[model samples]
Target: ISQGIIFVSLLIFLLVGSLNGRQRTFVSDTVENKTVVEKSVTDYLASKFNTMVIPSLYCIVLLIGLPANALALLILITKTKITPSTIFLINLTLADLFFILLLPLKISYHFLGSNWLFGEALCRIYIASFYGSITCSVFLLMSISIDKYFAIVYPMFSRSFRNRSKATFGAIVIWILALFSIFPFLLSQQTLYISDVNITSCHDILPREEQNSYYFHYFLFLVILGFIVPFLVIIFCYISIIWTLSMNARSQFRAKMLSTLVTITFLLCFMPSNVVLVIHYSEFHASNHSDLYVSYMVCLVLSAFNTCIDPFVYYYISDEFRDKVR
Candidate 1:
């Protein structure tokens, strides 16, 4: 009976050992499978483009945009009276400042081969601000377009309601709306470590499975309300302005020129990225893979130039702005 008890104990020990060994082996296998399944940034089509083209552009934007936007903000505030026009210009400059201030991290991310050393929280903040600023610009530009439409098309009638107080309120609502639009990104993880490259990418990679549930809808809505709607409104406002102006105003040329510039800025800076991102997230949601992300990244780089271009828009949109410069 004593010998029987010893045998049973030995059998139980062996079974436990075997189970632990199997568990370890399973865990290792799952990790190995994950490594093999996930493609690193090095293998990505945009990887080379990111390391090469993006950093340089970001550097240029940083060098040029930081001071330009700061100066524009100062001028918009101290140089002009706080009219609706000036309020919009101030907010636009603020948006550009918020975006370009984050560019240093972006530049470092690219320069270091897309490795994100800043950790997860910074990554989330970076992406949130990145997109928040973009949406802000789109919305503010639309507000400005509407302001221009009221000022130019119905100047006499608009004077009753378009005051400093209303403009300030509008600006606040737009700011809240723009950042609120990015609330989803703020809630999710934005940084991932790629085993193949031994690098952590900040918002450079999206989880293949996460898009279908929420992101697909978020990006689509963002593009529509944040960009497409604003774009159409801007176009309508500009068309109305051009149509309403009398030829003798010589200011007719200024209106036409400003309209052209605003259209070009929207087309070049905001439209492509918005379009590409919609396609990217949609395709990624459906197929678990996307090919247009490289285009989206490139277009985002173009969007960053909106930082440099916004000051010019201020000059054209506000006569007070032009007067301040002169």
Candidate 2:
């Protein structure tokens, strides 16, 4: 698995390097009208960050996350019995797998200095998949926390709730919701020509006019459903679990430690990006491209790192899962 990961990572790096030189002329021609003086400092910094930093980070994620998630899936499938938590995990792994597969296109786009060589349809698909996976992963993590809450706090009631059919149904529902939530992206024209930069960007760097219309609505929807709702649910569940466990002397230590890990994982990997996204969108609506936008993009990249951290975290939390992998 490690070897496969390294090989794919190197191959992607080579592929990105080769494509980087080919798309320069197209990009140069695209931004001919707008001079450097007209571009905001945020835009300049954003362009540089997207080109230099984001692609390299994405490649690193692909290297570590791809195999890690794949191994997690394999272990879940071959070694463990089907349970509610594992079911949720399987779905999460699949979501991450699908999302990472699309990263090469993103990496290529960033590497080529935000020049989108692929047509508009692929751009829409990429946006949809990226956001969909994020939504799915967050929701599933929330589901797992809820599952654990029931298992620990109300063990008797948990038996019925923890059945395979229910877990499968929950997974299906989360996926459908995730996919449906990103439909607005599919409906929009994601690829836009930046006259200033003389390049067509896939998603992130959009024309100003386009940012106000539908993009605002899409991101608002994401903040509410994708981040806020899930954040509240996960927090409430963990808090309740911690409270319940605190009263019980037997499991308190394990519960507190587990809750800490989950909370840390969510706060570290997910919270920063979502918080910045909200702030970034607020500034965006005001037509002010603050440096916060750069911070938002950086946080977004950090969010992707969660895919790699998730499996290890899960392994630590579940003794069955750990034994199965061993």
**Per-candidate TM-score against the hidden true structure:** 0.85, 0.83
What C-alpha lDDT does candidate 2 achieve relative to the native structure? 0.73
lDDT (tens digit, per residue) of candidate 2 on 173-225:
99999989989889877776665556776665554555655566777788778
**Candidate 1 C-alpha RMSD relative to the actual structure:** 18.7
Give the C-alpha lDDT of model 1: 0.75
On lDDT, the candidate that comes out on top is 1
lDDT of each residue in 86-144, candidate 1, tens digit only: 88889889999999989988888887887899889889888898989989988899999
What TM-score does model 1 achieve against the real structure? 0.85
For each candidate in turn, give its C-alpha RMSD to the true structure in angstroms. Answer: 18.7, 10.2
* Candidate 2 similarity to native, TM-score: 0.83
Position 5, candidate 2: lDDT: 33
Instruction: Report lDDT (CA) for all predictions.
Output: 0.75, 0.73
Alpha-carbon deviation at 135 in model 1, angstroms: 0.5
Model 1 worst lDDT run, 10 consecutive residues:
20-29
